[model samples]
Target: MSHRALEVLIVTGPLGAGKTTAVNRLLKAEVAAGRRVAVLINEFGAVSVDGALVDAERPELAGVENLVNGCVCCSLRDDVVATLKAWCDQPEGQRPERVVLETTGLADPTDLVDLEQEPELAGRLRLAGLLTVVSCLGPVDHLRTRPLLRRQVALASLLHLSKGDVDPSAAVAWEGDLRSAFRHIPLVLTRNGVAPTDSPDPWRGDLRPVPEGWEATAGPSFAAARSFTTAWDHPVDPAALEALLLAPPAHGELLRAKGVCAFAGWAARNDGSDRWAFQLADGRLEISPLPLRADGSAPSCAAVVIGTELDAAHWKRALRALEVPPAGARRKVTVRP
Candidate 1:
């Protein structure tokens, strides 16, 4: 008899769509059920915020790795393959039952799925599912302006809506829009942390491998973009940060923006202190104080923007507009696979 390798689940989404939150939910549920798991976070920028969040939530994971400083599709393909192989080689008694990968927002699902077709990794790893989280508030507008978001929605096997509770009545129209985009997949509305299911057995066999030739049409290649990270020892003014993203330069081919930062003055209504989450998309921005941490410690900010052309001068000028003093001198940014 032959031994079977561990099953792997992939969680992906566009920037600011809440893929990390969904993975955390699934990890907690799996842990509670006595299943050991491992997580691999492929971040587009130099800093790893999503990876940090996962470690903070599940400190006991069998393995938690971060592939930062580049997009997974172009630069980290071999790294992902090598990592999965290492996990599979672990002793059977210590090997995890499942593996989860949280891809960068701008990443196309097909890029990661294509790994299975590779001769080296195909037999070692099994595709459990392709779970994608879509922010209900952003998808409708993003699809109109961003080609990446549209491709993300079109390739999902399990579609989850983050912040869906904001407007319950919009479910009907949302469902219709999803159906028009992805008629064959399952779209589940999730709120807080609960998924809407009539029965307890929510896991179904709906996820399948990406069809051939899915990547050629999924927007721009991950190889053509770059990710940069900047840390600030000083807290930023929430209002000022909001204004910068709202009026980012129209020059170049920039496509996506996302990150979290520390605010010194702004405070939540419930608890009066300084902590916030920032997200930008399609000329719109959202700024809200984060409640869990109040003291305004050393906050890090990272951004991943895709452009057809690369201009360091334009990026420098844009970063200057943010007004927060750079913690360390700016370093040369490059992509490594």
Candidate 2:
């Protein structure tokens, strides 16, 4: 009897760059083909909004794990290795055929490439390749300010140019810059948040060793990024919440914001569901209703924002204002000292 290395793929991108969307599309297709696939999402926040988003989209998936409150590239690196080892130890019949790891925007993908050689994971897990998702619609200035984005691009085996449908001309211009900057890396344009099927799948092939001198210079450490998280049991006013996400207290430096929260009496046109999901990236906002859980219960309600110089007190105060009051109760206002 021979052992088969667990196939693994790494997906990296900047905040609001559509990493979750790309991963969801891939997982959806893999499961539809009857392949046993799992996704591990690393979010730089206390609550795992990305993980909950995955659950909403692919309720049937059983291996969606989230590593939150830390970046696996640094703080939680050991935990990631342990998880892979545990997966490898599972019985053959219960093990997944493929695993996709989605890294946080603040994560340095370069640090994680060493996972393939970990003693415990050496033979059990195989590194496929790195896929970096770049949002064509986002402000290019982020590239200059966020060095992690450059490192992600430099380490990628495949560059996924997302949001092409939003602005074709912008997408073309972004592609030109990417081609000139990352000329050696292969790139693909994605429309409607879906990666192309005929293209070289980011996680399907043998690992391609990054050439010498491909590593980008180090920039600000992960410590430069700060995250704020809020959770409320009560449903909120959707309009007020949307406004808050669109314009953070410190709007200029706020990079990414996303979460699943309870919306008062909200339901999709096709389905009567109460839970809703919202995402704000690079000033673009998206809000949609989540599917009902299999058990017919509401999902967790929480939101998180990651950026530089975030005012935690202001965020807390603003979120508190959006909470919907109970039928006979008055809204409570807290004055922070």
Candidate 3:
């Protein structure tokens, strides 16, 4: 029998739209069905909290690869192509049967899949589907003001709605608006992680490009943005760190924040020891304790924050304030691969 290449699944959506939750559910179902899957999580910030969440939730899966510090549509396009190629080159049995890519909220869906159109990475891979998750409770008014949201919807092969528990009337109204706006796409309403269908057709085809003149009116210089990363060696106060993130800079154009934090006076595991992770989206925050390795080494902490025209110094100051021990007491911070 001839060996079949892995199927790639691309999951994307607006900020805080529940993409991670949907991916988690899909992965769990795949595992229960005995399918081998690998995940590539792309983020627009220096710190990557979403990747950590996936690792924590599905540690038993094949493996999770993170492409951080920039949007997949911009800085990491080359990296994405490289990573996918490397995954495909692995030994036949070792390669994953299915691959899932969870894109950053700010990413442009059309730009990401078009990498295949490039001379170098094309033909080696096929796009299985483009799944876009939409939040029923999100800022609909804000989306109306930004063309990117519409572009995201217009490009999706499958449109999944999260927060199915919201008010019936509100959900109906939101669904109606989405149906009208995305008349060509297939829509599915999910509640508590249950998707309406498990068929493959929901996410297959070439993604559609954004409508003309939409980019010009959305914002000035959308392509000029960049994301960078910084890592800390010293422990952090989980509560203080949460507070600092909650109170982001007034003028800062922060698009997203996600990562794990090492805390002082905290054990590395249960019965007095435990590590903590924070996942922030839109305005909601979820905290959970992670199991620690038996080694006595300190837990490394990192985060990825996305924005337009960001200043590293501004972030350094805010992060330093949240550091549990004085910055001078620890080794110099370094970004990860």
TM-score per prediction, in order, is 0.77, 0.90, 0.80
Query: lDDT: which is higher, 2 or 3?
Result: 2
Q: Please list the residue runs of candidate 2 whose C-alpha ends up more than 4 Å from where it truly belongs after superposition.
A: 59-62, 205-221, 248-252, 265-272, 330-337
Q: lDDT of each structure?
A: 0.65, 0.80, 0.70
Predicted candidate 1 versus true structure: per-residue lDDT over 177-198, tens digit per residue: 8778678877788885467656
Q: Give the worst 10-residue stretch by lDDT in candidate 2.
A: 205-214
Evaluated with lDDT, which candidate comes out highest?
Answer: 2
Better of 1 and 3 by TM-score: 3
Model 3 alpha-carbon miss at residue 231, Å: 3.1
- State the local distance difference test value for candidate 2: 0.80
Q: Quick one: ranking by TM-score, best first?
A: 2, 3, 1
Q: Give the clashing residue pairs of candidate 1, or none.
A: 75-337
Backbone clash numbers for all candidates listed: 1, 0, 10
User: Which numbered prediction scores highest in TM-score against the true structure?
Assistant: 2
What candidate 1 gets wrong by more than 4 Å, as runs, is 1-3, 117-122, 139-151, 167-171, 197-203, 212-215, 218-225, 252-255, 265-277, 281-337
Residue pairs with backbone atoms closer than 3 Å in model 2 (clashes): none
lDDT of 3 by residue, 276-297 (tens): 7766666666677764444533
RMSD of 1: 5.4
Alpha carbon lDDT of residue 134, candidate 2? 95
